[model samples]
Target: MDTGPETGTGTSEQTTSQSARPGYKQLLRTADAWTFLLPGFAARQPFAMLTIGIVLLVQHTTGSYGSAGVVSAATGVSMALFAPQSGKLADRFGQGAVLLPGVLVHTAAIAALISLALAHAPLWALLAAAVPAGASVPQVGPMVRSRWAVKLNGSPLMSTAAAFESVTDEFTFVVGPVLATALCTSVHPAAGLVAEAALTLVGGLLFAAQRRTAPVPSRLAGGGTRHASALTVPGVRVLAIVFLGIGSVFGGMQVSLTAFTQAIGEPGINGLLYGTFAAGNMCAGVVCGAIAWKVTPQRRLLVAYPLLTLACSTLWAVHAVPLLGALGLLVGLCIAPSLITGYTLVESLVPAAARTEAFTWLTGAVALGQAAAATVSGQLADRFGASAGFLVPLGGTALALATLLTLRRRLSTTRQDG
Candidate 1:
């Protein structure tokens, strides 16, 4: 079956070029890549919006920050557990097959979560639904990237695609939290969750129906006996560790900000604070996007990681109301680009056959990190205060950078030999 956006093409075709692919800059200006990607970017927004909105809704409902933390943690946990499985499913049948199902499952779960909250159901029940939700969360990032890569034939356009995804993500994050918070604060607290569910389901379906951008199903579902063993591959293993570290930092950043808000006597500003951080990330993404050059993925990471480390660790210097949040904003600017760079590197490093599974591994790593931070960071905040809670993630970020630096020698040598 024709699965990509160009459904009329009848079959998935391999049209890769032996010629040099366009640079990252020119890809953005190119008509084809943008046509495929722009819609994909638009499709991704609702997913982020709902995810953020629902988390806030659940957090507000339970009133126990711990319960809220657990519900949010469930999302990370579910996504971690199912990401590889979901990716494998994507690889096999088609990304569209997996995408729609995941979105539906997620939408249903969100509805259940809202209903559970309204019915005053136990937190335990809500947590159960969250598992399914996480398990089915959208594969948008990986799916879209994979399509772009295949479509663009390994062009520098891939980096531009990565930048586009990151930037779009930042845009979603910025709008998602603000809109979610605003909706939740309204007389109809339930409206936000419903809107999220609807958007996710509709968006997911719309994306799946867009044949131009979907993946061609190879004998993927039943034909190739590919490995869960992809997990065992050396480069993937290394990348997984990097993801784990980075995920911890991202997850920990959220928990820290939440804790920080409370500690500074302005818990109400939490959404706005996150929105600020997202704004900075969005700005960074735009800058990254405008640059048409492709710096080696490793070089980008090497430069970006240290900046992440520095920004994350330095927020403690402020004694002002919004200044701390402002510093946090500064810190977050490079975060999405760094992540985009990392994912781009991962995609470049992994084999095509293993792409979906590889992306899953990254998602799982992220989920694991977020869940752990939510579980631990909160308690740490309870004990030593929010500022101290942050130190753990900052330290983790530094350690991750160190690990990456240590591996740089081997990695650089390997890439050159190839």
Candidate 2:
């Protein structure tokens, strides 16, 4: 049976083999690609902003960093739990049907959260509002990447697209904190959350309207036989576990950096230090995208993972602010490439039907890792000082390296089959 292009994996593969290396200009010009990309970029801005916003709001209203930490943790946990379910829904239904409603609900909940905080609502009420707010956040990152996979599917341009997305992700993380902090401090404590809600709604709606590039629902693609969950796919669980370690590095770095800044009586410079870290990733991602590499994604990860481990290990020994900032930049250089490689591997491992869910699961693993790292590292910093907290990320990177080494054979097999 010859399915139409929308449902035809074979067609995508054929196109990929025949296509030449597409430069950035050529890729950008391909079929409303900017229209498709802009919304995703806008939608993702909130991912960086929300946690900071929540922390600031809670702290401002309640005068308790401990309470703020709990609220932020609750939000992360809710989003991590729900991200895969949201992706599964998008896979089963059309993106528009699933995304638009999810975005709306999530935005509304964020607005309500801001209002509750502003009104000085009961602590429980404020905490309760965060659940729905986080739960409803559309899995925009996964959905957008899925669109790129469908559009660019077997082509080399897919690597470029992934790199571009990684760069944007780095940009969002860098900017989100600065923007959130600026708004919360200079304008009003609620402004950051308000901006997040507005941007999410607008960006999500714009993204959903680009129906032409959205992946076909699994049911429609497969004539209603349920697709296997991405989790069921070989090697996916292992990849998720490795990504968890990677995420722990990120989470631990964040908490440790903040603690370090506070310890040095320069808490305000935390955003600057984070931007330095993200800047390194952004530059590296661009370079990675521009160059054509002969190495497979698995091999690329093997090299990058150890570099990350080395950079993070160095972080544990650095006490001077200037030296630590340079090390942070070095760590950033390793991060984007590793992430891009991971996304590329996920694409190869999972079937088209389960792509979004698989990607979301990877993201969820990172979130869980981050949450765990933050909790543990926070305590370590409190008890033994920020320098001791650096061990959390150092340990995380070491584990990631070990996992990559242990699973290289399985990963190679999956890539070969893919």
The residue pairs found clashing in candidate 2 are none
What overall lDDT goes with each candidate model? 0.67, 0.78
Could you give candidate 1's per-residue lDDT for residues 66-138 as a string of tens digits? 5666777787788888888878777768777787667777888888888887776898898887788777777
**Candidate 2 ranges with C-alpha deviation above 4 Å:** 1-18, 61-66, 115-126, 413-418
Model 1 residue runs over 4 Å out of place are: 1-25, 28-39, 220-229, 262-268, 292-295, 316-319, 409-418
Tens-place lDDT digits, model 2, residues 1-418: 2222355454754374337574566567555568778888998899888877776677679865446656766676788788888888888887888888888898888988888988999878887888888788777888888877776766777777788888888899889877887788778989989999989999988889988778888777778877778888657777787778877776777677767887898867877787788888888988888877789988898888888888888777789999989998998898888888888887778778788898898888777777667667766776788887689888887887787788777674353222
For all predictions, the C-alpha RMSD in Å is 4.1, 2.9
Task: Provide the lowest-lDDT 10-residue window in model 2.
Answer: 1-10
- Clashing residue pairs, candidate 1? 4-211, 4-212, 5-211, 5-212, 5-213, 6-212, 25-292, 92-220, 92-221
Q: After superposition, how far is residue 287 of candidate 2 from its true place, in Å?
A: 1.2
- At residue 202, candidate 1 shows an lDDT of 74
